[model samples]
Structures are given as structure tokens and as C-alpha cells.
Target: MSLTKAQIVENIQNETGLTKIKATDTVETLLEIIKSSLADGENVLVSGFGKFCVKAKQQRKGRNPATGEEMMLDERRVVTFKCSGKLREKIN
Candidate 1:
């Protein structure tokens, strides 16, 4: 099962003795910072965690699976994550 934001906030509240509101605010602020950084095309690196990068993709040709029709996909930026070696080792 995947962990949700509420679970994270609850865990933080339990572990740190913080109130629900404070824990939720902390999580929200942290997420906002990460989102803004990525939107600005700046990579965010957290030691012992991972790195979040903004990657750019050029316009490309794509096909619609439903109709098998060829279409052009517009260029866009995407966020990618690379876990730290320590995190990868721990997961393994």
C-alpha cells in the first residue's frame, strides 16, 4: 500500500509530539518549497534521501492508442527523482 499525506502527518505528530495542525503545516510547506523549486527548473537535492530534477522534453510525434491516429506532442518539462545510494541500498 502507498503512504498518504495524512499518514505522514500522523506519523510526524506521533514521533515528534507535534500537534496535527503543526505537522500538516510542516509537510505542506516542505512540499510547496519542493514544488516551487521544480517549477523554477532548479534541482532539489536532499542528503541521504534523493534528488528531484526538472527535465525538458522536446516536441515529439505520438500515436493515440484508441484510434491509432498520429499526433504531435508538445514540448514539456517533467520532474524526475533519483534516490540516494543509501536509500537504494536500504530498499534492496
Candidate 2:
């Protein structure tokens, strides 16, 4: 099952004994900070969990299957996540 923001906030509140509103605000602030860092082309590393980096995707040609029409996919920056080896082992 996928975890939602509400669930994350709840978990944080339960673990830290923080109020729900405080937990929610903390989670939101942290996510915003991470997003800002990625937007600024900076890498974010969460030790033992994963690393998040912005990667440049090259422009490429793609075809629409229904119409068989060719289109140019524009180059863009995307965030990529690389899981730490320890986390990978735990998952496996």
C-alpha cells in the first residue's frame, strides 16, 4: 500500500509525541525544503535511506501509438532516487 501524507504525519506524531498539526507542518516544511533544494540542482542525501538528485533528460523523439505520429519530447530536469544498499538489502 502506498503511504499518504496524512499517514506520514500520523506516524511522526505517534513516534515523537507531537501534536497532529505540528507533525503535519513539520512534514510539509521538510518536503518543501527538499523540493527547493532539488529545484536548485542540489542533491539531497538521507543517510541509510536514499539519495535524491536532479537529472537532465535529453530531448528525444517519441511516437504516438494511436496515430503513429512522431513528436519531440522536450528536455527537462527530473528528480531521481537511488536507494542505499542497506535499504535495498532490507527490502529484499
Candidate 3:
């Protein structure tokens, strides 16, 4: 199961003995920091966690699956995550 933002706040509160509101605020602030950094095209690397990257994609060709029609895909920026080695080992 995927962990939600609420779960993260709960975990932080439980582990640090922080109030729920404080934990929630901290989590939300950290998330906003990461989001804003990515919005500015910067990579965010959290130690022992993972790295978040923004990648630019060029415009290219595409095909419709059912209709077999050709189309053009617009260029875009995408967010990608790379798990840290420590996290990968822990999961494994």
C-alpha cells in the first residue's frame, strides 16, 4: 500500500513526540520546498532518501493505439525519482 501525506505526518508525530499539527506543518513545508525547487528546474537530493530530478523532453512523434493515427507529442518537463542506495538496500 502507498503511504499518504497523513501517514507521514502521523509517523513523524509518533517518532518525534511532536504535536500532530506541528508534524503536519513540517511535512507540508518540506513538500512545498521540494515542489518549489523542482518548479525552478532544480534537483532535490534528500540524504538517505532519494533524489528528485526534472527532465526535459523534446517534441516527438506518437501513434494512437487503437486508431493507428499519427500524432505529435509536445515537449515537456517531467519529474523523476531515483532511490538512494541506502533506501534501496533497506527495501531489498
Candidate 4:
């Protein structure tokens, strides 16, 4: 099963002996910081975890599934993640 945000908060509380509210707030703050950094087109790197990068994508042709019509997708910035070697090793 995929881990949810609530599960993360619970785990943090268990490991750190923090109250639920504190754990939730910590998780929320961390997420907000990461989000804001990404929104600002800045990469976020966490040691032993991963790096989040913002990349620009070119406009491309796309198809509408329902209408079967061709459309042009607007260029946009997207966030990508590259996990640290340590994390990759642990997962393997």
C-alpha cells in the first residue's frame, strides 16, 4: 500500500515522541517549504533522500481521448525527483 501523509505524521510522532499536532505541523511545514521552493523554480535537495528539480517542458501536440481531437499542450515547468544513491540502495 502507498504511504499517505497521515501515515507519515503518525510515524513521525511514534519515532520522535511528538504529539500528533506537532507531528502534523512539522510534516505540513516541510511540505509547504518544498512546494514553495518548487513553485519558485528552485531545486530542493535533501541529503540521503533525494533531489527535486524543476524542468521546463516544451509545448507538444496531444490528443483528446474522448473527442479524438488533436491539441497543442502548453509548455510548462514540471517537478522531477531523483532519489539519492543511499535511498536507491535501501529500496533495492
Candidate 5:
């Protein structure tokens, strides 16, 4: 099953013995930091988990399957994650 934000907060609280409020704040802060770093074109790495990075995709052509109409896909940035081998092993 996929873990939600609430579950992540709960896990942090349990593991760190922090109050729910503190745990929530810490998690939010960490997410904001990661977002800001990626916005600045930098990567964020959590050693035992994975690395987060922004990847750029080039403009491309595409078609609408339903309408059979051609369209152009604009270039854009996307967030990507590469899981650490240790974490992948544990999950599997």
C-alpha cells in the first residue's frame, strides 16, 4: 500500500519521539526545502532512500487518440526519483 502524508507524519513522530505538531512541522519543512532546492536546479539526496531531481523534457508532437488531431507538447520540467538500492531491496 502507498503511504500518505499522515502516515509519514505518524512514522516520524513514532521514530523520533516527537509530538504530532513537531513531527508535522518538520516534515513540511523538509518537503519545502526539497522543493526549493529543485526549483534552483539542484538535487536532493536522502542517503538510504533515494535522490530527487528535476528533469527537462523537450517539446514533442503528439496526437489526441479520441479526436485523431495532432498537437504539440511543450517542453517542461518534471520531478524524478531514483530509489536507492538498499531501499529497493527492502521494499521488494
Candidate 6:
């Protein structure tokens, strides 16, 4: 199962002895900063964690699975993530 934000807040509280409210606030703030940075088309690199990059895609053709209809998708930007070498080694 995936870990939820509440679990993260609990972990932070357990590890750092911070109140639940404080932990939640900290986690939310960090996430907001990361999101804003990515929306601004800036990469975010946390030394031991990973790098988050924004990638741009050209307009493309796509098919709707249910209807089997072809469609043209608008150009868009997406976020990509790459694990740091240290993180990859640690996980393995």
C-alpha cells in the first residue's frame, strides 16, 4: 500500500518529536515549495533524494480507449523524476 500524507506526518512526529500540527504544516509547506518550483519550470534537487524536472511535449495524436476515437492532444509540460545515484544504491 502507498503511504499517505498522514503517515508521513506521523513519521515526522515520531522521529523529531514535533507536534502533529507542526509536522503536518512542515510537510505541506515543503510540498508547496516543491510544486511551485516545478510549476515555474525549475528543477528541484534534494541532495540524497532525487531530482524533479519539468519536460515539455509537443502537440500529439492520441486515442480515447473507450470510444476508440482519435484525438489531438495539446502541447503540455510534465514532471519527471530521477533518483540520485546515492538513493538508487541505497534502495537496491
Top TM-score prediction, candidate number: 1
The candidate 3 region of ten consecutive residues with least summed lDDT is 27-36
The clash count for each model shown is 0, 0, 0, 0, 0, 0
Q: Estimate each model's TM-score.
A: 0.98, 0.94, 0.91, 0.96, 0.89, 0.96
Query: Please, what are the lDDT tens digits per residue for candidate 2 over residues 1-92?
Result: 99999999999999999999999999999999999999999999999999998999999999999999999999999999999999999999
Worst 10 residues of 4 by lDDT: 33-42
TM-score of 5: 0.89
Q: Which tens-of-lDDT digit does each residue in 1-92 have in candidate 5?
A: 99999999999999999999999999999989999999998989999999998999999999999999999999999999999999999999
Candidate 3 structure quality by residue, lDDT tens digits, 2-85: 999999999999999999999999999998999999999999999999999999999999999999999999999999999999
C-alpha displacement of 5 in model 6, angstroms?
Answer: 0.7
Q: Candidate 6: lDDT of 64?
A: 100
Model 4 error, position 33 (Å):
0.3
Order of the predicted models by TM-score, top scorer first: 1, 6, 4, 2, 3, 5
lDDT against the true structure, per candidate, is 0.98, 0.98, 0.98, 0.99, 0.96, 0.98
In TM-score terms, candidate 1 sits at 0.98
Better of 1 and 3 by TM-score: 1
Candidate 3 TM-score to native: 0.91
Runs off by more than 4 Å, candidate 1: none
The predicted structure with the larger TM-score, 3 or 6, is: 6
